[model samples]
Target: MLLSPTFSILLLQAASSLAIPGSVVKRADPVVQLDDTTVTGIANGTVNQFLGIPFAQPPVGSLRFQLPRPLPSYNESFPATAYGPVCPQQAFNLTIPSDLPAETQEVLEVMNSGSTRTISEDCLSLNVIAPANASVGSKHPVIVWIFGGGFEAGDPAATDGSVIVNKSIDLGVPVVYVSINYRTKVLITLAFGFLAGKEVQEAGIGNLGLQDQRLALKWIQRYIGQFGGDPSKVTIWGESAGAISVALQMVTNSGNAEGLFRAAFMQSGSPIPVGDIAHGQVYYDSLVNQTGCSNSSDTLKCLRGVPYDTLMDAVNNTPNIFSYQSLSLAWLPRVDGIFLTDDPQQLVLQGSVADVPFVTGDCNDEGTIFSFANLNVTTDDEFLTYIQMYYTPGASVDEVKQILDLYPQDPADGSPFNTSDQNALTPQSKRLAAFQGDAIFQGPRRSFLQQRAGKQETWSFCNKQSKALPYLGSYHGSDMESIWGDGAMSDYFLRFVTNLDPNGNTSINWPRYTLDSPNMLTLLDGSIPLQITQDDYRVEAMRGVSGLMLKYPL
Candidate 1:
């Protein structure tokens, strides 16, 4: 029975549904030995699992604030089962949308029950999941996932890879999955981890979290073979700050992946136009002042010496994505002369992006949830103050007016896309949401595609299935359910991982993104009605926003 390509993909999806993870157990204990040290992992029917494998030495004590150090060996029989402690981070809470359906609200409760979780500084670890049949006789392509929280928050424990691995087995395109954890916020991520002042910059160390990711990739290249993964075939993927990091990794070392990864995938982030390391002086000063290291001759060394709790106390006092700044998060990757020599946008313009096949996309209303904190802003004057203080502070009055004019103040004109007048929380709420949706996520993504399409095989998408969450239409992180669940997005991802192209055998062909065509595959309802439409949402308005970004690179 030779099924056609389209029917074959559909049948494969059906096969995946029947064998959902944990439904059956074929193997009990699976042992994978690396350099004479044996780490034991469990096995479900379809995929073998290895969790909490140390890719790097725990960055504790004197290693605080330094780049990740690769773990030397795993010489003993270690049980790799439960998750390690997540990176230390301030507890984040979201004000649930009032109009959410009872069912949706219930789901949120289940997700948030573990919101109050513990974390530790000893958090550099990774997890791997492979098809039960993977081996040297069957080297599966590796899909390494990097999680996102504006680079200020996120833990690798949040993502599970069993379904995707199972999807591959059904499709006859088996692959391996890996998830990683690095530093974030002041603990060791965003630009905050690589926080630099005049002294720290002189020492030439920044973007430490990104460096941690790079080290993890190197680890994969060296050790994934032991778990039936191909070292030469790797795709690094992420969303938001993780997406931003994916783009940064594409451009780092002048777009040379250093033989670590061969492809990239992103969700709602691009090579952001952040200024050099010195711009983060305020946060660095606040950290030094809080930790009583302001007077120290070597603040970097002093930070390394401070107790974890003391350092975390000062870090928690800092503003996060939920603060008044909103999507204009202060703690994120920046141009460090070491990791990044110049502005990432400039680097892209100068043809600094990786020459690899990649997929990048954004949700329809990326800023709705992120801008919820700034809803109190009402009048035009306050809006101008916000633009000056957070987004593009140096923007002249005329430029700020230009941005406001483009985004507008009408609820219909703002995000939460199809909703007419229901989401106008305040006079300026919808307007701010519109601007942020474009500036942080949409604008950069568009420019990156235009600049890099010709240089590489690129694909793009826009997730418009808002899920009817009041004002927060297809908000940030909305694509996760479809991509990770049993939907076309998940199928597309399985196909993409199988053959670096989402349209490998699916009926809905995803065309390569190019400047001439300028089309985007739209994920709506995650059904057959999913569209491949023009990428012309808000062209002129977004163009103006990109111009303003030069003067104020957030």
Candidate 2:
């Protein structure tokens, strides 16, 4: 499909206005002129960075729960030198298992340290990092990154793009890197960005965060060429919540790419078995009651008028990813009739996904970290009740029993797989971990691949690099280091971003994933760092779990 005239005008202005002649200015700092604004960037040896550029109008005041609007044009010039404030993050009071190793805690803390930046509702900005000498019309492949924090907490600054850019430079495949910020939880007296219910669905304002991401992609299509990038060859990449966001982006708009991104790269996330937006009525009502908006006829409007501190307090009191509910998040993306026409997994089954080449993978034990919040469920009866209440709400006793049979209570058969009976903090800890990981992460990924394998190009991997870590084997988000550092996976990713295939001039070629030959590029911990293996570890169990989740959408 071709771009509209308005986008064509924006693209022409962004490219022509930004083309600077060599003799015009001689300085260490790099600069690009777009529309009427002049952007000055920092010169860091291998890459030049332009940070904190606004892509959308600030979503504040009356625009609180509304979809993001793209910026019309820039009127003034500003120094794009430092990162902007991050969107407000939802607070979670979690209790990590006391028996967890100190090293594990340190790793988790380091991963989250970047989110300590100041936060604000006016944060709808993005960052760009390009090779040092990249100029207009250079046509470098663009990689847009989205950070992940379970859709509740995360910032664009969480991962550094310098590692990937620098490595690409060394490998003779230069590329441009971009990361964007979107609303998460709101602090002011208003419905959260992900608020859901009949009112929200009717207003067509649910999943505001996802809407924010879509607008950013449109912004990229209009302006990325100014930074010497080929918007036509753009790739959308993310991990965890960001990965889930990427998957949703692929599946939304009736599987249309809309000339925004040409490919996708996901880590630890896929199209989940989530149902209708109306399913979140309880949380929406709770927010309305806590904000004292139940008395008003226009409750949504009343929520918009609530005080900031009161709204923040109510949002804080809700169940977060670390709550006893674990993966059942309170403020999350749902099937809002407009943006998401149906459940994500159902969309995949209906063939409503973008026909693009992509990569999706997970860590060996993607459940252990989330299992910590449910340490109270020590007995078999308590475990059954917890599962029935949270996951299998409408499932019968026989169906739930069938699920239990597939995932036995024996710790030896649970997560941190192959480590027999060692890391069960409670009697049901590992067992619950296995189930949650499959339900939320593994099962959805496998199902998505099986459905889309022959239809489009696909590749998958399993990161077991940190399998030696105590309770949390190769836990969720552990592969982040490899992508953000000068590691093997980093090279593979660079190859993918530049060539669309993660194999070229390398001995170990990554084969495309298919239903008949379900191959995986496994990252391990021994002297041999990488190997090819079948993605058939828990075939029958995963099939049973996927079927149950399809019947009982979360």
Candidate 3:
């Protein structure tokens, strides 16, 4: 029998109430007694006493690439009052444009400044926040957030859930907010290197980062009820690579956390083709060659013996590591025949996904952040050369002419194309942006929705607000403003999290997406409020790209 949304919701509700068979005692401050560490936090009129807890054993030294071991049972209460260390990452320096206003500049400075922001391998931890009046029977819905940094960089602590938590409390719908950390960079993707010649692949090797997330969910299932959250009503949310992870969890059977989570929110990340075992083998060989671990000794052991900094240096020295246009990075989830059995896009096409309610969308200018590398284009000829060289491989002169004809150049006017094209591009740039956006984001999004449309409950959105930034044009990570907004948007996210709807009673009709007539929720500027429309150009482009994907299955 086919899975039904009603059945899924009911199952989750039932799972939330499941407790230790006969324990009946309830407490007002259950977290204080249950966790060894606890600290109070206040922001935006809401008070959150947090508990820092370990969900798994530290993946250090010998356990580096192995599956996560369950956290040791602590007999005494532990203090989880402060944020834990961030996962290891290469130091990144982002330059704020001189055109930014002083206030915006200050905000950006605070967002990026900190010597403590340096990466470390010893960074697997979780943070929990609850309302001041949190109790056992309050049964607040829980949101487990996973941050995104292209599987390379990000910190759970960087995102402040105070706004969302505060808004939830004010609306009489309290929520427990959680942010978790997992291994990053080489630690995550290099597991494939260790699997060579092994008969059975370990659970953590190819996608240990994902395994870490699942372990955290299991911990939530076992302990969240004691902290005023309904364990069964957990919702997993993420952006960028985090969003891709969410999509992975939805499709992978290993992601079946039983009754832990019921809903998912994916922002700016969708499942694309992942590397296959054969391709993974190539990456593993490259790592071996770069690190001088070519000896007959166990490759995994040799890798573990190398100093963390040395390994990082080797990764940095590699040519074109994150050059997405050339697809050179090796640190991505792989189809290792274990946690991930098949490509996610193919799974979606076959309607093989967890039949749960989903809220998914992309920022207006997702491509712009990536297009920074192509900024040297000063003329139409330069732009066309880039397209022929990077986008379509082995295209002859005739094909290039056809593509140019299809997307003509207008030297007179410049307008940014897609959500990120606000600075004005030549007509040729606009067309290139559309094609690139389709190949990278919009196409995948449409294909994902179409595959899941008739099978599950789906909601779609397009965030189209510039918010004080002139040229950004709602680029990547903009919807974060709504989810963790300063005021109004925060309230909207709170309402949506507690009750599967974001609009208040007086709000306009917000309909669910359907396969026959897909409608998208547009969050635009002005007092116009939310609106819906059905334009399937992105979807059509995806169908063509999907055909191309068959030729090059990652």
Candidate 4:
């Protein structure tokens, strides 16, 4: 059939609008075909990206809080140029309270910088970055990064992968990068994936965000080759909650990788000792009542129907990680009887972790940044309440008293660990940091390594470089700059992804962590830095606090 004159003219006008007067034509949109669907992506310099590519159907309507469903076969074209919106996040950096110390204020800036402001429910997407030379013929090893925000917020869009891809290309060890987004802090200003109630438990749909991640891995397995990635060699890496997420993924299937990934990298986090979903019944109930879903036959479905803004307001008004019991995040992933058969600590004890080569480490002062939010707890009574509320509520007064004795009141014995009285923002600030850090980050990581030492090759590091803000010495995420920048840490990471060992071409002797000699690579900011040191510091403190984590997890 011949096109009408009017229609032909319209088509020509549309084509002309896309052309620059004398610009040299380069190429059509970067094209990729998965199974049968054609995705037209963006080509920028030496990095080619297919962004906002859906790895699973949108989790909305009837699918809310349910396990992600793989998209069926398709023959349509998908425009993969821009990033997908992130999952909902609380409006960040609104008005800051003025009384905070200058250092604490500075710490907040970096922590808030990691969240992407734009958000929507349709955020289950992943981005693929490859070297310009990559194609079906060049199967390069892959690096998959997961962002962290206390399981309350995070956005893959907040970070750039071109840096990694370009660094790999520069060092002559090109690799592909994949970053993904998942629902977090559900019903809150954002959505957390693992909110559970009896209604949810019976349905077996908790941990929706993690399900989103596993689906992305499956997608990579099915189609990463089209973008010149070796799916079999994918290494999962993350920092903070993302790091905790990496550890959780290891134990989810009783250590069964299911051929989804081969190795792991964690920064400042670990498989926490969170209890069953029933522990979160209060938050679920609060959400249901606030969203006016109390009488609804199916509360989860009722939540899906509530007005978005209304539901967000209710969730936001409730207790959050920053509340009095700082870091006791109520909306975090818990043992839901499905994805997690039991508490992760028990799983680790049962040897249910993947027997893969891994690296796990922490910043010099992982607690400083986290402790900034609890500057209000200055007195001994407040401190006791904090311990009961966040650490061991059921513990008798003697247990709380024992915790105080172990942590002590002296700033030097506290966090920003060797800084002495310098960063004592409050009387109890340093003490709180010390206790929280060991309970949440340091202790779990050390325990994780000790449990896996004889079974797998593992390396640990302590980042003292980029020790930002005076008080928050090498605080949580202090290593991020080096990890993403073309710095030593980044170089080591590239080497690790390219060849499962981080000591690829360096003379630096990074040793495997072991029970007999628990050595860690100390990354400091000076020439001749990066020393191999023993993991003996804080030994007594960690041992003293280990049982608290086991009894009452945050």
lDDT (Cα, tens digit) per residue for candidate 3, span 1-554: 00001122223335534634455334333345455544333321234556446678887788766777787665655556667776665333345557655654543343333326545566677887877677778789999998776565566766566546766777778899888887755434333122322311433366778878888888888877766789878888888778888888888884454776888888777776654645545545656667788784677677767777777676554322134342223466767677778777776766667777887887665554444334455466776676556554445555555445444454212113343434543334445444555555666777788777777778778777653354335556656655554422455555567776655752465577788888777777788746786646544445665445533454
Runs with alpha carbons beyond 4 Å of true place in candidate 2:
1-27, 108-114, 187-191
lDDT of 2 by residue, 1-554 (tens): 00001122223335644666455444499899879999999987668999999998987778777788888899899999989888876775667545568977755443333256887778899999999889989999999998787777777765567667878899899999999988774521123568888888988898888888899899889998899999999999988888888999999999999999999999899998888888888888888999999999988888777876777788878887778988877777889987789989999999999999999998888888788889899887888888888987889877888767888899999988889998888889999999998988999999999999999999999988878788888888777766665655877888888888999975488899999999899988888888998899888889998998898887
lDDT of 3 at 286: 59
lDDT of 1: 0.76
Position 471, candidate 3: lDDT: 38
Whole-model lDDT values for every prediction: 0.76, 0.82, 0.61, 0.77
lDDT minimum window of 10 residues, candidate 3: 1-10
lDDT tens string, model 4, 1-554?
00001122223345645655455455556888887888988886677889999888888776777788998865788889999987865433322357766756645654544343567777788999998778986889998888777666777765678878988998899999999887777621134476766776887877776777888889989999999999899999988878888888899998999998899999887888888778778888988988889999888888877777887787676555555555777677888887888888889999999888999998887777667668888988888888887777767787777778888888888778877688788899999998888888888889999999989989899888755456777777777766665555777888888888888676487888999999898888778667888999878778778776787654
Model 2: per-residue Cα lDDT at residue 69: 89
| Per-residue lDDT of candidate 1, residues 129-190 (tens digit) | 99887765467899998887666667665556787787778887888999988887753443
Question: After best superposition, candidate 4 residue 395: deviation in angstroms?
Answer: 2.2
Best-performing candidate as measured by lDDT: 2
Model 3 misplaced stretches (Cα beyond 4 Å): 1-31, 35-45, 93-115, 186-204, 254-257, 280-283, 319-329, 376-415, 418-432, 467-471, 486-492, 503-506
Candidate 1 residue 427 Cα shift, in angstroms, is 1.5
Clashing pairs in 4: 88-190, 184-191, 184-192, 185-191, 185-192, 186-191, 186-192
**CA shift of 90, model 1, Å:** 2.5
